[model samples]
Target: MTISLHRSATVLFQGDSITEVGRLVEPDSPLGNGYARKAADRVRSARPDSGITFVNRGVGGDRIADLRARWREDALELRPDVVSVLIGVNDTWRRYCSGSVTSARAFEDDYRAILTQVRDELDAQLILIEPFLVPVRDEQWAWREDLDPRIQTVRRLSQEFGAALLAADGLLNQAARAAGGAEHIAGDGVHPTPLGHTLLAEAWAALAGL
Candidate 1:
């Protein structure tokens, strides 16, 4: 059965650019212009009386290390009941593009540290979204070698932590295949388009039973 969020629960989303998507840092509009926002909207629409609160702390270009640096401030401090995280793509991207490689072991360690902190400090329910690549460009196919292991790592960690796992990669791939191609979902192979974000929001809502 899908997990149901309690009433008045605070939900937090943490990740990279895909999750960031030009979100306002100001108090008024916290959840960005991506799937996070869409998901929030859907939840409110589905349960207008739930009084659930949502926060988006996703920063563009963030990797696992970056999240580690700001975990206390962005995540723990908020004391959210549910924390949804989408990361790791930038870790893989930096290796190929900038030669700033983060080995799989290191990635898992850093990630586990964040999860451990959340578990110990807040005891919040976790939703781990796997990092995905659509391979819209031929060169993007090579990213599979690095990203796949990280995805597996996330799956293992989710089970270990009793977190809900959102299989975004496979879901998006299937959407892409039905919707003509990856370009329709994520034109850049990394970031999702409006249609892609909608798919993501729907997937999260369904998986989390929001």
Candidate 2:
């Protein structure tokens, strides 16, 4: 079933670079040029009088631990009615590139902690987006071993927390196949292109029933 947003609700998007998309940190029009912006636009267009306010707090290079560290200020205090989170890639990426490894267990723990806080602090709905890689570069295929488990963790936690899950990995993979190749969707296998963001927005809208 599609989750419906209440009128005058505050919707918050949280995650890493994909969600950030250069969003302004200030109060006015914070959604950046990414899926969050696209999704917010669609929802507002569909119901201009819904009185839904959107906020983006996604920072580049954030891992689950980073999110846990800032949850109180960036999320809880906002008193959002709906929260959407897309994270975990950096947790796996840093291990391969920067040698800063965050194990799957730690990732799950931090993620759960954030969700627990949200559940205890507010009557907010949750949407968890799955972390994905497109394998645009041959070396990127190797990231699956690390990212796959984190993806599973998100799926399990979403169920545990009664949150909606967006199967972004599978959705983007299908989009890549249809669009001719992975590079067409995500040029570097991690960050998404405009078309990739569109796919994400459409998938999010379909999942949220906006």
Candidate 3:
């Protein structure tokens, strides 16, 4: 599907820390130093007079449930023309770190619910970024048992909603191998380093056909 971030479009980025990356929360705020800012920068460079607004509402440690809980205020109320999401890692992270397991079924259910709301209530366009993993350690590889299914869920939903799908998991791993190690991109197998963020931003732009 083609997603056009047309003139005067307000694109909202939603998800966990990966999207948030320390963005400020204030009037006339600047996007944080992460992929969201970088992606916006890429588009603005090509269309200087587009008058586009990019909003980042990524809260660190947020699971799908957390995002749905505040969806009305953070997402729906903004009335964005386009919405991009990079979530699900924290859902698996919490399982390993805090014993909070979010089954893939629950993840898909909550995700579809919000997407339905976005479509039915706002008729906004969607761009779904697949959650990725690059295991720095052998143990982190175990995360695949949890993350892979969710990645598939993202793909299915993207097709179901006719949204642009950024195949980030495969893209990042390919980059990591070329860069010599996963740590070079995502130091912790989760959050991205500067280069990793660049990859995500470029991938987002390219896949969204920006």
Candidate 4:
């Protein structure tokens, strides 16, 4: 059995495009085509009448530093009871393509700062989601070298912040392996297919015990 989280919680899902998934682009949209939508559905189905609210503040193509830029507007102001973050993929992708690299040290600093602000300023329960790439395409392989360390850093940060860790990267990797490879998830290794979103929802529900 999973640990029971607070009922009627206002959960905020934050991160890059993966988390954004066209949620706001569509009018009257409460969820998207990604894990945010899936996880919100699971929580609502399991805890109906709990009066829980799920907010999606994830923006497309965001990085750790970007999150910091919009923290006050996207996160702090939300006053979430539970905050879930799924970032770091864009950081990896940018660096892999000879793009400007945000050093692992810098990633840690920015990430830690964001979490600290949420913890100290908002007093929200944190959920750190480890971002993953399934190597669906040739370009994705290079991402592992740069991305792995950041994923580890996030995991450790999760512990440091007393946040629930959703090992989505590892879990998705395993799911990919079991499903015959990277194509099982994201065809491009960055975005998730419908199946990938399902796996993420399962992992989140199990972790949050919703």
lDDT of 4 by residue, 72-167 (tens): 999999888888999998998888676879899999999999999998998888888898888877766777899999999988998899988888
Prediction-by-prediction clash tally: 0, 0, 0, 0
Residue range with the least summed lDDT across 10 consecutive positions in model 3: 22-31
Q: Which stretches of candidate 4 lie over 4 Å from their true place?
A: 1-5
Q: Which ten residues in a row are the worst by lDDT in model 1?
A: 21-30
RMSD of each: 1.3, 1.4, 1.5, 1.6
lDDT, model 1: 0.93
* Superposed Cα deviation of residue 166, candidate 2 (Å): 0.3
Cα lDDT tens digits, model 2, 100-158, are 99999999999999999999989689999999999888888889999999999999998
Task: Return the clash pairs for model 3, or none.
Answer: none
lDDT of 1 by residue, 64-158 (tens): 99999999999999999999999999999999899999999999999999999999999999999999999898888999999999999999999
What candidate 3 gets wrong by more than 4 Å, as runs, is 24-29
* Cα-based TM-score, every candidate: 0.96, 0.96, 0.96, 0.94
Between candidates 2 and 4, the TM-score winner: 2
| Global lDDT of each candidate | 0.93, 0.92, 0.91, 0.86
